[model samples]
Target: MNKPDPIPARLAALKTTPTHDLKKQWRDLFDSEPPPFNRRYLESRLAYRIQELTYGGLKRETVRRLERLGEELDGGDRKKSRVRADRDRPTTGTRLLREWQGVEQVVTVTADGFEWQGRPYRSLSAIARAITGTRWNGWVFFGLKNHRRGA
Candidate 1:
């Protein structure tokens, strides 16, 4: 006969377990204090930990493969990866249009700069200044900075 699976029962118990017991379980499993999270979060993470402890976690080869992919994606530099992922520049050939003083201004993104009024400009801040006659942040003026993936 096949052995019965205990993972389901253990996971189900997480829902019925007292909050203090869940915190103690978390400390025992993770070897650290429980994070200041809601009960649901605590229960879910405890369930995962219980399952992992019983059945084991990811294989060494899978972890190595993931690390290799991460290195290729970010050149193995965590800071550079963060900076690159946060950059919000639009792709080349994108056209940005804005209305200023009842006149429409158009700007085109190029491989190396931006084009406006048939002239190439080095920076978007310069373009915003040319349009408004005052200093303005190009990304904010163009309404793109506020749309970041994670604020």
Candidate 2:
């Protein structure tokens, strides 16, 4: 029996063909069951051949063709190319107090707490007391109130 020509010979024959055409031929070659020794050796060598051809060129068309060939080699599934977003994406939260019902009606007090118009000064009492010397009366006052020596 005669020895068959190697895959390198076959790949060399394909060099002059268009990239897509070469990929199709290669796919056909891979699909066919070569002899046992030929199968293992050809698979590894063909992969290296592809990578060599891909990175050897600077042309955009060459790069695109290489990418296409890579896609076909990995089972021709476009879904595999998709990437999931990382969990660290920034997020914002709403603060109820930041948006008061009627901000104009709300008062700032020497004693901490908000005083809303038509509503008694009942919220943020501790905040007002901690910030101001006296109790808040729902009026938006900025200046410090005089604290008596004993009150």
Best by lDDT: 1
Clashes of each: 0, 5
> What TM-score does candidate 1 reach?
0.48
My TM-score estimates for the predictions, one after another, are 0.48, 0.19
Q: Which RMSD values do the candidates have, in order?
A: 16.1, 29.4
Per-residue lDDT of 125 in model 1: 81
lDDT of 1 at 13: 86
RMSD of 2: 29.4
